[model samples]
Target: MINKIVQNMAEAMAGVKDGMTVLLGGFGLVGQPNNLVDALIETGVKDLTVVANNAGGGTTGLTALMEHGRVRKLVCSFPRSNNTIFEELYRAGKIELEIVPQGTMAERIRAAGAGVGAFFTPTGVGTKMAEGKEVREFNGRKMVMEYALPGDIALVEAWEADRWGNLTFKLSGRNFNPVMATAAKTTIVQTQHIVELGALDPQHIMCPGLYVDRVIHIPYGDPPF
Candidate 1:
């Protein structure tokens, strides 16, 4: 098997290009892949469609990405947050947005990873969110058809990763990271700890090596080969 570890964040992010859709794994600021985000900023690719749970919480990370004019559109549940960066860019029409219900958003990413083509839900029924979308009734209740949200690349944060790419997440830090690891063509993870292949307990593992493509060490550590 080919080694999945890269020497630096730059190498980890070398595949990201302009006009690509990326799944950024996190909920609010928690679990956001800071090292990868920094690498993307340095890479300076633009016209991106970023999918995430929320816009970056503060004036850095995702906010800094917007300030640098990298993202063209955003698919997320909460666009408004601690920083006004997205707001200002959005108001000036500098960015595009699609607001989804939080639960629906999670399922959409999960559905993509699970190979589910489409599904119906009641989240956006009767609201503007359902505009121009197919709707139907099931068991006397209304549901809107939503498509899966697969991405060209997914950047996830994991608390620990085995040398072979199996990952385990920390408490709440697991937010969105597991599913995002499977929904993208390539998944690059920024992990806090890199353990030997058998170091992780099978029961504690949250994502298998089959889904993860690259393992990167945090604080910009050298590649773990």
Candidate 2:
């Protein structure tokens, strides 16, 4: 097996550049890849398009990117109550925003990874969310078709991973990481623990090694939250 480990978050994020679309894996504040987020902030890459369920509560998750004024667009399902930076940017027209329903967001990413161009869902039928979108009838119900969202890079958090890159997430953090892995051109993983090859059970691996391009193990003493 090829070893996918990297020395640090900076090395893992080496290829990220300006004006790139990045998919961030996490639900709320639960399983965000903090180390990678810090490194990206430090890299100072600009004009980023971030896709996530929500921006971190404050200056925590993707909010860090917003603080740097690096984010040009956000394709997210919802904005957290404390995400003042995002709200301000949106209000000021400093950033472009595309709001999607929570369930539709997940399906969009999954469809992208599966190489599907578009799929229909009934989640937003008859609502403002359905405006300008392609609509189709399925089993007597109206459904809107949404296109897949593929990103240039995907930043994800994993609870544990092997040297070969088999990854697993803890609890709620597993929300979007797995799907985002396959939808991005490059997938960078920040993990709480790293183990030798064969350390993790095959059945427990939520994301296989082939989908992962790099892995960084956060230091044991480092604060995750």
Candidate 3:
């Protein structure tokens, strides 16, 4: 098997460049790829577009990238609560924000993974979320077709992964990791534990080796809480 494992977070983020779209996998502060995010900050690559559930709490998760003024756009569900920098940048006209509903955001990333261009849903109908989006009627109700979101890189957090890059996530942290893995050109996983090949059960693998291009073993850190 090809070894997708890297020495550290810096190696995991090797090819990421300026103005790239990155999908960060985590929900709030839980199961975030903090080490990789910090490494990206150190790289000083700017003008990033990050897609995630939230930016994490203030100085944590993707917010670190925002602090360095690296992020130019955020494609997220709700930014009002967790992201201070995002709010400031939006008000200052320094970044573009695309507000996707929670469910739709998940579905759109999944659609990208499945190689589908667009799909229709009733989640945002009759609201500002529906503005400028193509809407069609279905069974006496209106639904909008949202396009898929494919990224240049996917930064994911996993509970454990093998040297071959098969991964498993913990609980709710699995929210967008699996979908984002397949939807990105290069997928990097930051894992709490890196085991030998064949250690993880095939049935339990959340993301298979083919979708994952790199893995970083992050030593345990206090959960951003």
Candidate 4:
């Protein structure tokens, strides 16, 4: 098995360039790849289009990337929160928005991972989400066309991972990390603990090593409240 461990976040995130689309895994900051996000901020790359569940708040994680003016567009389900980082940017016209239904967002990324180019859904039909999109009838129900959300790179967070990149997520923190893993060309994981090969129980592994490209171990504690 190939050992996918990288020395640090920088090494794991190498080759991230300007104007590239990146998928960041997390529901808020719960499962965010903080270390890797910090690396992106430090890289000073601009014109990034970020795809995530929500735009981050405060000055960390997804919000940090937006705060630094690195983000050119945001594709998310819930773009608002107490932080207002995303809102501030959007209001100023500094970034563009593609609001998608939460379930549709998940499905789109999952479809991309599953090698599906596009799919039809009734979730957004007759609503603004369906506007300008190709509409078709399925079982006599109107459905809207939505494309897959394949990304150039994926920043994922895992609770634990083996040397081979088999990952286990903790509780709700697992949220989009697994799906985002497959939807991106390069999947880089920030793991809380790195175990020896074969240490992770197969049943507990939410994501197999095949979907992961690199693993960076960062010992972190609970999410900031």
State which candidate has the highest TM-score. 4
Ranking by lDDT: 4, 1, 2, 3
TM-score of each: 0.94, 0.94, 0.94, 0.97
Q: Candidate 1: global Cα-lDDT?
A: 0.87
lDDT tens digits, residues 24-143, model 4?
999866888888999989989899999998878557888888888999999999998768888878999999998999999999999999999999999988898998999999999999
Native-referenced Cα lDDT, model 4: 0.90
Candidate 1, residues 1-225, lDDT tens digits: the string is: 556777787779877889999999877667888778878889989999999888777666788888899999999998888878899999999999999998888899999999999999999899998999999999999999999999999999888898678999887779899999999999999898888878999998999888888888885433222
Candidate 1's C-alpha runs over 4 A off are 219-225
Clashes of each: 0, 0, 0, 0
Candidate 3 residue spans exceeding 4 A from truth: none
Please write out the lDDT profile of model 3 over residues 72-138, one tens digit for every residue.
Answer: 8999997865547777878899888898999999888988888999999999899999999899999
TM-score of the candidate numbered 4?
A: 0.97
Per-residue lDDT of 56-100 in model 2, one digit per residue for the tens? Answer: 664666887887899999999887646588888888999998899
For model 1, give the 10-residue run with minimal summed lDDT. 216-225
* Model 4 bad stretches (over 4 Å): none
Give all candidates' CA lDDT scores. 0.87, 0.86, 0.85, 0.90
After best superposition, candidate 3 residue 127: deviation in angstroms? 0.8
